[model samples]
Target: MASQIQYADVEVGTELPAASFPVTRATLVQYAGASGDFNPIHWNEKFAKGVGLPDVIAHGMFTMAEAIRVVTDWVGDPGAVVEYGVRFTRPVVVPNDDRGGLIEVTAKVAAKLDDNRVRVDLTAMSAGQKVLGMSRAVVELA
Candidate 1:
């Protein structure tokens, strides 16, 4: 296993290896089942369209979870992340039939903090749309 990244030695503009994950209908259903957030909009097409959604959509949290995996994977430990947040600049707009696939995560070191922590900025996109999750992560490295 890769050791926790040592934070103090990091530099500005450092780029982390990118990661891509797919969000399919089955995965969304699984997430819905696991999270107990079985809102109709997440799985019901008619309901989503009624609410003006193009189709069923994945939960924002789900995308966020996938986005964070990129950092945790690069850092070698998800527990190393001390702070993380993002702004939902755009909706996933998952199709009630099929949510788009290939949610890719690309990240770079935006800033470095004291005490072995560094800020990571990320851009995530899927279906050719900017899904602004995994926006930032501050990790404590060994």
Candidate 2:
């Protein structure tokens, strides 16, 4: 699918709308079941703390997926993204509470490429700490 956004209309440094995703204990369990990442660190608080984490944490892949929503939403097509990558810098600590943890993502066009593509840089933060570093996506625009 082609992106709703046009490459000709986009400019470097244009900010995409920011998005936030809530990560609860149930969310982690569901992600674990779907991704087959039944690591204790993602569900068991005691296990996570025993391993030096503050508490139960969200899966790294789950956090990365959530962060990319900003770019996908802006472009209006998931298939428009040709490349995406991120370095896991910190864990998203999901507390066993009603409030849980919020993953906040913001993205901007970093570079315009040939063939109607643009590079979007993303920042993902959770609990006031950056969780994903060097996060970027290359999208084919209309």
Candidate 3:
């Protein structure tokens, strides 16, 4: 599918819609099962805390995927993304609670590239702490 977003309509500093993802213990468990990443740190609070983490944490890949929804949602086509990468800066601690953890993502057009493409920079935060660093995606626009 072609991107609904047009390159001519975007600017270097334009902001895309922000997104928030709710991540609970159940969410982590589901992701673990789906990805075959049944790591103790992601599902066992005791194991996580024993390893010096505050609590069971979300998987890095799951967090990365959640963060990029902002870009995919904005572009209106998931395949429009040509490249995406991020550095894991901190863990999204998921405590055993009703509220759980929230991943807040905000993105902006970092640059207007050639060939109907644009670079989007993303910031992902959880528990008021930045979890992903240098998060960026190169997306093709119609």
| Worst 10-residue lDDT window, candidate 3 | 1-10
Q: Where does model 3 exceed 4 Å of error?
A: none
Alpha carbon deviation, residue 142, candidate 1 (Å): 1.8
lDDT scores of the candidates, listed in order: 0.81, 0.93, 0.95
Each candidate's root-mean-square deviation in Å?
2.4, 0.7, 0.6
Task: Show the colliding residue pairs in model 3.
Answer: none
Best lDDT goes to which candidate?
A: 3
> Each model's TM-score?
0.89, 0.98, 0.98
Whole-structure CA lDDT of model 1: 0.81
Best by TM-score: 3
Instruction: List model 2 lDDT by residue over 102-130, tens digit each.
Output: 99999999999999999999999998999
Give the per-residue lDDT digits (tens) of candidate 3, residues 17-37: 999999999999899989999
Candidate 1 per-residue C-alpha lDDT over 98-133 given as tens digits, one digit per residue, 9 for 90 to 100: 535667888999988887778899998987899884
